[model samples]
Structures are given as C-alpha cells and as structure tokens.
Target: MQPQSADGASRDPTKVRRNLTYDQCYYHPAPLTRVHGQDVRTRSVRRQARIARREAALPSSRTAVSTPASSGFLGSTSYLSVFRETPRLSKAPDRSLCDEFEQWRTKLEYAAARVVRLASAIPFYLEQIRWYYDKGRFTVIPAPIVLDSLSQTVAHMESHPWNVTGNWASIYSDLMAATKSPLEISPNTSARQFNSLFTGPHLRFEFIGFIFAMAGLSVQGRFPGRQSLELGNGEKMDTDAFTTEMVLACHHCIEVCKQNSHVNDLTIWMRYMHILLATEVLGEPSERVYSLFGDLTSDIYAMGLHHQPSDHVPFFLAETRKRMLAVSHRTDKNLSTAMGRPPRLPHRYCDEALPLDLPDESLFEEKDSLERFLQRLDDGGWNRDGKFYPATLMRMRHILSNLREQVLELSLGRSTHPNYTKDILATYKFSQTIFNRIPSRYMYTSSCWKEMDAIECLARMIVRLEHLFSVLQLQRIRCQENSEATSDLLDTCLEVLSIVVDLTGQYNIHEIKKQFAWIYLLKPRSEVIRTLSFLVSWVRNTVTEAQPSVMVGACLELNNVIFKLLDDALNYRPPLGSGQEDARLRSVDTGQSFEISIQGTRGDLPSDVFNIGLASGESLSWLDDLDFMQTSSGLSLM
Candidate 1:
C-alpha cells in the first residue's frame, strides 16, 4: 500500500500514516483515534488535547496557514500543501480609482452648470409668467409660488457646494402633488368644500414647474454655445455646459416619474408635454417619443378624460381634463397626418364637450356661476373676446381632426361611405364659419393688421391657415376629374403658402430659427409644404395658359419661402468648407448660363417663365406618353 506525495504521486501508505500528526489528521479523527483506541472516549479526548497543543505551539506567522476549515471543511486536505499557502488579495488599481473620481468630478461640474443655467433663466421665466398673466393668458395661480420656490432652490445651489444626483423622485412627487387643484371633489366631498377650494389658490404649481423644467431643457438642447456677452457681472457663462446639465436634470425628472409603478394624470400630462416638445419642437425623431405617445393615450383613456365631464365635476378640473384631452387628440392627429398612419385617438371615442369659451378668471367661480354661463352660451350668447383664443383653438382643432379623418378615409379608399363628398364640403364650410366667427378685433386685415399684437396676429393666422388647409384638402379630392376644382384647390394652396410667407416675414428670422421657439409657426409652415407640393405637382401635370403666369409666380415665391423655412426648421448651420466647384455647383452654373441664354433670346419672357415652360413641357410630354401607352394596351386587348 502506497501513500500520496504533494503532487498526488503514490507513496508508502504505512509510512505516510505514521508521519501524520493528530493535528494534521483532525478531519479524520475517528479513524486515527480508533487505530489507537483503548477506550474510545478517552482516546478521542487525548487526540483533541494533542491537536490543541500543536495549534498553540505554531508560530504567529504560520497561524493563517495552519488554521483549517474556517468556512467548514468540505473535504480532508491533509495531503495537500496548497491549503497552507496564503495568497494576499491586492487593493483595486490606482487607474480604476482615478477613473471613478474623474466620473464623479464630471458629474459635479454638470450639476453646477445645470444649477447656474436654471438660475439664470429663472428671471426670464418669472417675467414670462407675469406677462402671460397681464395679457390674460390662462395661467395657474401657483405660478408665482413655483417661481419663488425655483428662485430659492437656485439661490441655495449657488450658495453651497453640492453634487445633486439621483432620481429626484421626492422632489418631483412633491411638486406634482402640489399642482392638483384642491378644489377637486371626489364623489364623496361636499359641494361647499369644493366651492371653497375653487375660490382659493388651486393653481397646479406642479404643471408650472414641469413647464419651466422642460423649457430649460429645451433651451439648453437648442442653444449649446458660449454667449458673446458675459452673464450678470462679468460671469463668462459656458452655455454648452449649462445645456448639458439641464438635459440631464430634465431626464432625471422624467425618469423619476417613469420609475413609479402608478402614474397619475399630472405625471402623464407632464410626460406627454415633454414628448411633444421633443418631437414637434425639438424635431427629435426618437422611437421613444412614439412609445411615450402611446402611453399618454392609454393614460388619457384610463383617466376617462375622453368622456365629457359630469355636472358634479369641478369647473377647473373639467377644464383641465378637456384641455389635456384636446392636446392629446391634436397631437395624435398631427402625428398621424405627418406619418401617414391612422390616429391613435379616434374622433368617435373622444366625444367630450368643447372647452368653454370663457376666461380663466371665470373658471374658478361657483358652480352656479358656471351653470348660468353655460345656459347663456346654450342660448346663443357667446362672447367674442381675445380670451376665447384657447377655446376657439380647441374648437378649430376638433374640426381639423374631422378633416384629418376624412382625408385619411379618402386616402385609404374608404370614401365610398355615402355622402362622403357632401360631408367633406360641409366640413369645409363649417370651418370657414368658425374662422369668420373670430372677433373682427382679433382678425388680421391688411389695414389694421400691423396694429395687432404679435401673439394675437399669430393666433389669427393659425385659424385662417387651418381653414384654408381644410378647403384645399377638400378641393384636392375633387380635382382629379374637375379642372375647375383643381384650379380652386391650387388657389387655396397658394393662399396657404402666402399666409405662411407673410407670417414668416412678421417674425424676426433669428427668433424663428431658434429651436422649439415658435411651436405655433410649425403648423402653418407644415401646411405650406403640403400645399406647395400639391400645387407644384398639379401645375406640372396640367397646362393652363390663363393662370400660368400667376401660378408660376406663386410657385417661385413658395419655393423661396419653403427653402428658408426648411433651413430654419432644421436649424441648419452651413459647414465651413473650401469654395470648390463640385458637380452640383457646375450643374447649377450650367443651368444659370442656359437660363441667361434663354432670357437673352426671349426678350418678352422672364427667366421664371422659361423655367416654368420647360418644366411643364417635360411633365406634359411624360403624361402624353403614358396616355398613348394606355390606348395601345386597350387596342391590343380588344
């Protein structure tokens, strides 16, 4: 019988057993004691005493090596020397520590930047609230309170050295909870209590906070650069850094809401609002935007906001629900129209009553006051005031939603539903009536248009543009067979383009070019693109000498405006490159030379005239060839 060596090679078993001490055989105590047994209990006791004495006699340096089964032995290691070796565990590398420290430092810098950026913009936001209030814009009461809180927060950040990080869930939750109008009555609350709540400051400061935060984020995302002038007293602000911090802060706020298992209406609305800004204003084509939009619609349905508010519902809350619903509907409609997809929110599902055409001040009044106002409105006592802008806009949006549905139906070849054409024409006429109902004071007439405030003018233009768009869309369907209808549609499209061009001229180009700066302007600009594309295609296909000159002129004007608007909408900044003649440049130069030659030859015709003639001729020639092919195919079939 052989004993095993250190590397597991066979050795003399008897000799190995003889050499093994009681301490080394601790795991096999029963076997060793049995071999030396006189009385089993006494032998075991003796073996244990000997093992204890051997352990105590070991040097302090060897204690770690000699200690067996600290974690409880799974198997005997008496023959293995590997168990005696102590391996020192090294600390983490300096590079790893440095990297972590660097990350923390960067985060701190970003936080500081965000605080400064938010603080600097606080004054501007406060002034905006004041201005909106002064102008009778529908602002919540807690706007001032939220503004104060923001001011204090900014001051605290400035006064201290802090690294603000994490989800900020508590702050977000607190702010959102504050925005709920306390005047809101459940089915259980008394009417008297509700009335008292309504009269008190029930302005949702959470909403205000959300808007400010989102606005800060938007501003930061749009303008990432250094200001030429110093901020405050010689503070050279790094706007780009500030913007980065703001983006992170906004993301944190959103993430906090998202991480919650249950999202309330306020959070849902805030999230939806952010998505709108991201998609429409920021022009971010993220898939998350669409996903968030889906979630928003689901939330709206869950809250039952698609249905009309019951009489028991508070006026402020009802109005808020209606506005949120309207915004959701409009967002869905616009996105569907743009993407050529069916709208997520169907018009039939949203049968909520149109928002009241009353001032914000009227909303907080007693139930009786609102009931009486509704009675008057029902009896054809609607007032035409600038304050009605929001209600009017909502109504117009509803109409546009219907228009969009009709357009979708037509495009999908589902227009065979009876009286489709009549319904469309009726809608067009109704839209016009709505536009005409806007107070003459708010209307933009050439003589007194300049007298109107920019905001009011923008509102008027939006209404007019929407009406024109509806008319154009209606006429477009009929234009396939009726040249007269085609001509009418073309005119409507031109009017749309003209209105857009006029609106663009009214605003400072710099302001218009700013990211998400003028959301109202996007709708008209989009309409212009749509209308121009249709008109250009029509003009190319059809040859009409009577209005060729007029059509060509409109096309030229629209082309120029479209290009400019596109540049602005895309925030296009030209790259710094060498002025080299590429193929595209050479082609453009050749085209110009040809145009000059034609202008010289045709003294009566303008360059545009020649260009239009050539383009239309080519299109007409292509159409003729197509017709000839159809006729030849028909003959062959016969």
Candidate 2:
C-alpha cells in the first residue's frame, strides 16, 4: 500500500522507503540533541542491563526486540520480535490513518498532562493557604503580593497547557507513523514500551490521580474560606463564581481533544467533570462544562444508536463517568448524586477531612488566591457580553439524563454488572456530606455558588425526596380518613407537589431569573411567598369566622405547605435577587464600638451578637423574632 503524507496526499510512488526498525527509529535524529537525549540514552542502557540481569524476571519465550548498536552506542532500538512482519491488513492500508491518529493522541496527552501538572501544584498551594489562615493572616496578606504570585502561576500554567498539548500531539503522530511502516505491533505483544505509549507509564497514571486531587483542592481553598468571610459579614448566601477561567479551561481541554479527535478525549472530559461537579457544589457552576457534558451525553447516545465503530472511546467515556460518580460519592454521600436517589450522608463539604481541626485551611487558601484574582476583574474592566449566562439547571438536566442512562445500563445488566440502586445511593449520600458544610442562610452569595453546586443540588434533591415521600404519606393518610381529613391531606399533598413540580421544571428558567440562589431558583420567590402568605391569611380568616370542615381541611393543607416552604426558605441561602441584606451582622453603636478577631471560626456569632447589641437594646428582641418558629407562632401560626 502507498503511504500518505501529513496532508493526506499520496507519497511519491517512485521513491524507495527505508525499512526502519524500532532501534533505527530513535537514531533518525542523528546525534540526538534533545536536552535530555544523552541522559535518556544512558538510562536506556541501564534499563536494558537490568533486564538482562533479571532475565528470570522476563517471561519465557515472549517476543523481545534485538537492540543493535551503531558506532559503539546503544539506543532505544527495542521492539517485540513477534511483530517482525507488517501488521496483517484486513483492509488496505490507509497510511494517513496513522497520521490522523498520531495527531489526535499527541493533543490528548498534552491536555491530560496539563491536568496532571496542575495536580502537582495543588498540595503546595493548599498548604500555603491553610498556614496563613491558621495564623489569622489570610485576608491580612497584601493583595498585591497575592496577585503577583497568582499572575506568575497562571501564566506558567497557560504557557505549558499548549506545550503539553503539543507533546501529546507529537507522540500520537509518531505512533501512527510507526503503524504505517513495516514495523508491525501485535495486539497482545508483551512490549512494556508499547504499553507505555497507550496506557501511559506509572507516572502518567499517577498524574491522573493527581488531577483528581488538584481539582478537589481548587475549591477547597476558596469555598469554606469565602463562606466564612460572608458569614462574618452577615451575608447569608455565597455568590457563584463559576468564572470564565474555569469555563475556558474546560472548553480548551474538551475542544482541543475534540478538534484533534483524541482517543482519550472522553476520559479527560469525564475527569474534568469531577472538578466541575466539585466547583458546582461549592456554588459556582460552569456553563461550558455543563454544555459540553450535554453534548457528550448526546454523543454517547448517538454512538450507541449508530453502532459507531469508536467502541473504545465510548467505553472510556462510560468508565470515566463511572469514576466521576465514584469520586463525587466519596466527596459527599448526602450530596445529591447525578442519579436521582436518596442521599446516604447528610453533608458533603467540611474541613474535618483535612489535617485535624483544619476547617479554616481550605477557606483561607481560597480567599487568598481568589481575592487576588478578583482584583484583576478591573484590569480589563467589566463589559456585559450581551448574552445570558445560561442557567445551571439546563446543564443539570443533561447530566441527570446521562446518569439515568448509566443507572439503566447497570440495572438491566446490559453493560457491566453492579448494583444500580446501591451506586445511586452512594453518590447521593456522598453529595449530602458535602452540602452539610455550606453555611445556611444568606451568609454565602450567589457569586460563590459554584463552591456548593453539588451541595445545593443535594439539598434541593433532599427537599424533593422529602416532599415526595411526605406527599405519598399524605395521600395514604387521606385515603384512611374521613372526608374532612382526606380533603385536608390531599390539598397539602398537592401544594407540596406544586412546589416540587415548579422546582423540577426549571429546565428553561427565564434569562433574568437564572442567576438566582438555589432557593429562589426553585421558583419565583416572590410568587411562592405571595401564595404562601395568601394561604396563611386564608387559614387565619377561617379560624376567625365560621367555615365548613372542607375549609378546615384546606387550612391543614395550607399549614403543611407553609411548613415545607419555610423549611426550604429558612434553611437555604436566600436567592440571588431576593434583595434581602443578610440580616446577620455586627453593628457599631453610634457612640460606641468594639473590636473582635475572626480567628477563622465558621459562624455568625461575633457579627450577630455584636451587631444586634449595638443597633439597639431592642435589637436583641428583634433577633428573637427572626427565628422561624417565633415568626410563625404569633397570631398567624398557619
């Protein structure tokens, strides 16, 4: 078969090609001048000598390449002797196929490397932030110093992202190029060298693990810290910072692999989701990640339907998805799983898992880094991009759908054998653990929402299941009761359903409303509040005036709905547009003031206790009134 060039044109048919062996391949760059060429060559000799010494370590009669020396120097002329003949062609050789695959693999390896390299940096950064926080000096660190450090780090990472991409691309090109030559490789060849190129070396696999750790640590630094700051400031909700940097990173990785048609693109993309999911749990959600996830989900289905020849790719994607589900489950069981199931744990994010009593470390590090990054927001100046940042719900819909398919795959025992229910529960439970760390109330901002996406989703899901189960109970109770009780329970159940249905159906939330906190995102907070208020007033009116048992039943239903709503509202951070100042605060009296140290504690005690006392002696009374129980108990208990 004629060879094809890089651009897919046929190679000159008249030219005689050299028959290259694996050894000759390395020596092609005569007098190899790469920076580590000599060192690498020297290492090769040592490896070969060790192999010879431990010939007993080698399997008997397995294929072995003969390394030939030229000019008294040894090199990587190694190969599996079994593949001496050219690969048997089931179809005519399409030489360019080698070139294409080579290009794809090279890019993929680079993307993977970027993720890996970032992994290497995480432990260092995490430690740095925690130290400062412990000293009560995280925020006190000069912003400029932090900026300088970040600028350097980000720049270095940026430069290398492409570098890694290029290296992987080159490796792929070489591999494909090798495939086209008479240097045939066997499917079952016991060549350790060959396996390194495909599955990667021990370090490479370690890099993958490192990537997972890095992703987890990225938010660990910022999430708890930011929440702490916000709580101290009396802001109950954390803002979502699923910023452009993260979105762009996901985009670059996913898009590069897609463009190059990288074999492991799906694997990298799936791993990337773990980071995104963690980020989302922390409060910021990545539109690009979510969008890409949707596209990938659809692509998987398309491949399955078409019986696409890219079986290996799909298999990797599925496996990656499973791995992600597994990692996320580990992060927090009570956090919502991608699959809809009961949460196993009550919370997902916390500091307890860190070196003992280091709850403030993640937060301290994140704030140090983020505040610096945030300062740069003004460098280029802000300009609204005349487009809506898509609501996170759309992304969740796609993710949940993919998860559903995965669950089914397990349930039917069609793909791999595993317990579907157990897996789902595991993920759900893990997510819940993560959510438990998020401060309740408006102490966190919608801007920091990415940190708790998984947690918020878990909370929402919990609320949902709780609602569903309660509704079912209500229905059963209704069936067993007299008409009055039955009517009351039925109404209550419907109200619960109405609220849940509204929350679940936010698939196409309005553009303006999309950015709100999870609680507000459940439904228009105003509408829900209004409906609730009217329901309560109606009940109050009934209590004062004579009404039929049916009306009394409606009142019971209304009361149940109010309780559920209160559980959600009082429990969740206020929505983004709620326009409610986090009532949590510390106040300085007009004539008197006090100083307090933050000391990295995670609560509103300092701010609340002080502020209320300062605002007025009556402020303490006001605090008592803010409790939901107190608010509900007086006169309008319904």
| Tens digit per residue, CA lDDT, model 2, 1-638 | 33455676433221213334323422110111122435666645533322231111211121233211111211111111112222241111111112222333454433333343233343344343444333322121222223333334345444543222124333334324432232223333322332233221112232233233233334433444223212121112221221111222343334433443223322333344434533443222222223334454444333332122322332222222333333333322212222222323212221112111111112133446634433432222111221111112122222233333332223223223355445544533443343233223312222222343433433344433443332333233223322334444434544443433333333243421333335432444345566667767766664432554323443454465555544444354433654433332112222112223322222222323221221224423432223332222211211
The residue-level lDDT of candidate 2 at 425 comes to 48
lDDT of 1 at 563: 43
**Residue-pair clashes, model 1:** 5
Could you estimate the TM-score for every candidate?
A: 0.50, 0.27
Worst 10 residues of 2 by lDDT: 69-78
RMSD of each: 25.1, 25.4
> What does candidate 1's lDDT look like per residue over 572-632, in tens digits?
2323572442332343323221112111111222212111221233322323222222222
lDDT (Cα, 0-100) at 173 in candidate 2:
44
